[model samples]
Target: MTDPVHIVCPHCEAVNRLARERLNDTPVCGKCAKELFVGAPIDVNTARFNKHIERNDIPVLVDFWAEWCGPCKMMAPAYLQAARRLEPRVRLLKVDTEHLQDLAARYNIRSIPTLALFRNGREVARQPGAMDVNGIVSWVDALMRHA
Candidate 1:
C-alpha cells in the first residue's frame, strides 16, 4: 500500500493524512472539518509560514507585501482572485513584510509585493511587484509545467 499524503489544514492548523490518489478530489480536515484545499490566500505569520512552505507537497505561492505599499494594496484583490481560482491544485500564502522582516530579508526581497514560488520547500522562482490575476495564473502555470 502507498503511504497517504498528509496535509495541514489552513483553518484549524490540523494535519490530516489523505490518500494520495484522492488529492485531486476535495479533502476535508479531520479535526476542523473544513476543506483542506480552498482556493483562498492563507495568512501566515513567521512561524506558520515556515512550516507550511516546508511541509506542503503542492506548489506554494507566497506574496510578500506590506500594508503601507500602494501597489501591494492595489494587488491584494487580484491575488485573492487568483487564489480562489487555483484552489486544491495550488496553495496560496501571504506574508506580511512588516511582521516578518527576517523572512523578507532572508528571501532578499528588496521590494514589496514580491511573489515567490516554492516547490518541496525550495524557491524556484520569484517576481517583484504586483501582478494582475491573469498574469499571476500564467506565471504559476508555467512554474508547474517546468516543475
Candidate 2:
C-alpha cells in the first residue's frame, strides 16, 4: 500500500492524513467536512500560506500577484482554469503581494503574476509572466514530470 500523505484543508486549515491513491476520490476534510479540493485557488494570507506550504505533503503551486497588476489580472482566469485541472494533486494558492508584502519579499517576487511551484517545502521552479490555460498546465506538467 502507498503511504498516506498529509493534506491541508483549504477550508478549515485542518490537516488530514489520506492515502496517496485516494487524492482524486473527492476527499473531504475531517475537521470541516468540506471538500478538500475545491477546484479553485485558495486565497491565502500570511498565516494560512505558511501553514499550507510548510505542512502539506503534496506539492503546492502559488500565484503571487497584486491587484493593480494588469498581467496578474489577465492570467487570473488561466490560473483558475489550471486550478481545476491541477487540484487533488497540487494545492493551488494565491498570495496578494499588496496585502502580504512580507511574503512577496521573502520569495523575492520581483515580478507580478509570478508562479512558483514548491515541493517538500522548497521552491522547485518559478515562472514569471502571464500565460494562457494551456501554457499554465503544460508548464506545470513538464516541471512536475521531470522534477
Candidate 3:
C-alpha cells in the first residue's frame, strides 16, 4: 500500500489512519486502543453511521433492517458470515431502521433488508431484500470490480 487509509473505529467511532497492509494485524484504534476491524456487523445509529460512511476510505456495506422484520432476523447469520469474509477490505454495518428512522428516510430505504454499499461518502450500489452469504459476497464482489 502506498498511502495509509482512514478507518473509523467500530467501537468508539474515532478515526484512525493505518497502512493497508496492517489491516490484517488486528489493528487497534490510536485514540481508544480498541480493535479496528472485528469481523462482525457493528450496529449503528445516525451519528455512528455518518462517521463510518463519511470517514472510511474502504467501501462500507450497510444492512438497513428493523427488529420485527422476520426476513431481517433470518438473514442475520448470513450477514455475519459475509462480514467475516468481507472485512479488512470492506466495513460491514447494521442500522435498525426503526431506531434511526431519519437515516432510513435519508437513504430512502423502503425495505427491511436493504444492502447499500458506500464509497467516499456516496452510495455506489444498493440491493433490497434478504440474501444468503454467497449472494452477499457475489453481489459485493461484482460491485467492487466495477468500482
By TM-score, who's the top model here? Answer: 2
lDDT of 1 at 105: 90
The pairs that clash in candidate 2 are: none
- CA lDDT, every model vs. true structure: 0.88, 0.95, 0.95
lDDT of 1 by residue, 1-147 (tens): 457776778988776887777877788889989889877899998878887888887788999999999999999999999998877677899999999999999999999899999888899999998899999999999889888
Query: Which residue pairs show backbone clashes in model 1?
Result: none
TM-scores for every predicted model: 0.92, 0.98, 0.97
Backbone clash count, each prediction separately: 0, 0, 0
Q: What lDDT is reached at residue 6 by model 1?
A: 64
lDDT of 2 by residue, 1-147 (tens): 799999999999999999999999999999999999999999999999999999999989999999999999999999999999998889999999999999999999999999999998899999999999999899999998998
List runs of model 1 lying over 4 Å from the truth. 1-3
Rank the candidate models, highest TM-score first.
2, 3, 1
Off by over 4 Å in 3: none
Question: Which model, 2 or 3, shows the larger TM-score?
Answer: 2
